[model samples]
Target: MRPSLGRFGYPKSVRGYAVQAPGAPTLDVFSRRTKWLQKERAARDAETSRKVDYVRDEVAARLCERLLDIKRHFPHVLDLGANACNIARILTRPNPDSYSAAPVYEPLSSRVSALTAAESSRSLLHRDEDLPFNNEIAITRHLLASDETLPFAPHTFDAVLSSCSLHWVNDLPSVLTQVNNILKPDAPFMAAMLGGDSLFELRTSLQLAEMERRGGIGIHMSPLADVRDVGGLLQRAGFRLLTVDVDDIVVDYPDSFALMADLQAMGESNALAGRDVPPIRRDVLVAADAIYRALHGNDDGTLPATFRLIYMIGWKEAPQQAKPLERGSGMVSIKDVLEGQRTGGKSGNR
Candidate 1:
């Protein structure tokens, strides 16, 4: 299907999106964005550092345990779309063992360039290949949500780890195909992506102001891809024993402008798919900030912004499906399926 202008009058999918074969043009677009994301990486790290301390002190640390298990299976690993190379630096530290474990980050070319601005001080390496290493674990965070196509074959990876990245992607099924192809049979492809309930306050406020200001027409709000959808996606992708857990983090902002600044710092401001330029506003942005604050402001003069993050853990290194479900054997109950969701399970308490 041809790409169309979406609700905000911005172009939706680009021409020839969704990579159908190896060495396709879709690969070019994904590689090209690295230069831009690199510039913003520094700013984004700083913003998240300032406002998201709780996530750092608690929620984010649990990822280390997950990566440790993947490390045990495959000592060498690769991280794609490594913004600021933040995740790698956290996990690959303080290890003085003979295991010689290291994880590579394939950030977008733009982000790679930005890391260059720092010279040898960069965590992400500058490389975009079909596969970084042979017979190894390849993990990507939030890289799948943007592209309609991928540069991988089926069942190619030993293990895969994706965290907080897939919501930005467009074609769910096709992306899943690429993901499944690279993962070895019964090999767990554990990942965390944005769910349908993320950024509720920001999305609602921005939408209301846009409609009010423009007479029922406004720019499109970036859609939060669903976590529950991942279950079906995994089933169709032929993944088994899939487990998905949802978690929420409420990030409070001093005001709406502070939130907007952080998002801009993260290069997440644009909802337009074909946009190759940073969105420029020629008019007074302060007024728009004012309108946003007015609509989303709080009683204590603080805005409550909620971001939902889902954590998924599945094993891919296994070589076969357990077995097929007999027709109408009765769907599994929620309690039976979520048997592992106890203390220190995928779901952790506050």
Candidate 2:
């Protein structure tokens, strides 16, 4: 007989692993920002915020391309992150009325329509906690919510999209499960999040410098999920027709300090609970800066920072989607195929 799985089908030993453990306090490295409206502060930070939005715009555009390729119109869409409602703006542009369900009354030049548009951080919104839109594009609901806890009915949306978010989520699997539950069967769910390799140059430089200056390294960066883990995460969350891809974006900065400044403006600075209680030592920071320049410097005297984005596209599971074949259902043997290849068949041509 086969060995049975532990709770949640995770191995018993793995139950203690931070990534696999459900509701692990240690894994909650990111907490809701307690600062005074960080999003507003970021907006005022000038070019740094624009640089972060450049990445977000790329993610939003890629997601919109996929959505458009699906061809079928989505009557109801959900924007999970909705930071400045970028995704909705992309979808509704070209012609907002092309997507609107209503007949001509007055041109809805100031609004667009959506089933739900939610922002995890309320501070990201403008005066009324909403985007400035034409009357043509009206959002039915503007929710101040997080991915970890989506307050919506099950099978509620025709399509769902998230951009430049989900990397901050601590319990990724649980949030994915919640995302799955709210999506209608066969509906599309698309997201882009930073992958494990993001800021590797910075992380390595800091670690090496810290170990040399101090005795050991501290938790300077939050742990991010790898591209390899995403496919399984989608399947585990009851999503099929799964597709995952990686996009590596590298940006150059004047120095490590410049890079750190941009990260702060992006609101993506380290937030690990177990990070060093004391402030980082000046010597360690100085050493790290030197190391980063020495290793990653460019001809322009700048340094490159890599942002690895993992894009995921999945559909809520339904009977219509393709299924894997059952065991022993193959019509041809692998051994026979190999023999044919050796005997001057198809495989010999290459």
Candidate 3:
């Protein structure tokens, strides 16, 4: 069944998910129906889906690692856009190698009381629903829902986590606000999304190839978030104590065809709205492959594709949360301390 359209042409299925707060701009940059179809198609072949989940797995592990650093227990958590349950799997059966520094293998589920895995694609969600998880440790519930419109009550969760899913969201700021609203006061929200020059090599190669062949370019890659703007978004969403950082994960492929194929399997193919442009000409693909090799090929004849991941952490505002001291409350002037250090602890008057 096809998803009906709502305001700004969003999927009608998402209307009941949540009401968009007033004044929150609904950007129609992505086609939710197309995204769902892509994910559903990707999940059709289990083996191919698993093969392309390496990037998601890595990001989930890293996100969980950060979550583990917090020395607090989360009674309930939400895994937003939980494709294939990557975060759930990591939390339930954490790899001992990832935490070898610890004295023992402690499951992240031990700290999280319960988790809800919400996904936009039903096929992808069901693929992992039957996985043999230790239910006594990890109590997970699956929900088919859109990340663009979170269907949850206010202050419903102790924490919210997402891995490599927010990038596909059309109205990111609105979704972030929903995430903050659903999280309890002072609860943590941790997530990672592809952004900031991700797939630059392929993007550049495709543009150049199209320009050379067709004398024009098409939108080949989806636009991603910039790391610099993420902090501001968190603050705008009413989140405090924000932290944002980036990491690059490069994977080697035999050629551009292999890379594109893997991306399709990963359910990350371009789903930009109004992308009804004609299929890329075969000649352009040929030229793009050649250009890709010439530009970013490795010494061993393999091509390297970079996925830039932006990791962000923010906490819901709470009255009891720690706050910075009032302005000018410092006893010592920073300038004086810097000058003293510059003068080797000697007074400037001397």
Which candidate's lDDT is highest?
Answer: 3
lDDT of each residue in 159-257, candidate 2, tens digit only: 788887788777788888888998988888999888879999999999999999888888878788899999999999888888999989898988888
Q: Which parts of model 3 have CA positions greater than 4 angstroms off?
A: 1-22, 95-100, 134-137, 329-350
What 10-residue stretch in candidate 3 is worst by lDDT? 134-143
TM values, all candidates: 0.59, 0.76, 0.86
lDDT of all the models against the reference?
0.50, 0.73, 0.88
Worst-scoring 10-residue span by lDDT in model 2? 104-113
Off by over 4 Å in 1: 1-60, 67-72, 93-156, 274-299, 317-350
lDDT of 3 at 178: 94
Candidate 3: residue pairs that collide: none
Tally clashes: model 3.
Answer: 0
Ranking by lDDT: 3, 2, 1
**Per-residue alpha-carbon lDDT of candidate 3 for residues 8-35, written as tens digits (9 for 90 to 100):** 9878653256678878567799998899
Q: After superposition, how far is residue 132 of candidate 1 from its true place, in Å?
A: 22
Ranking by TM-score: 3, 2, 1
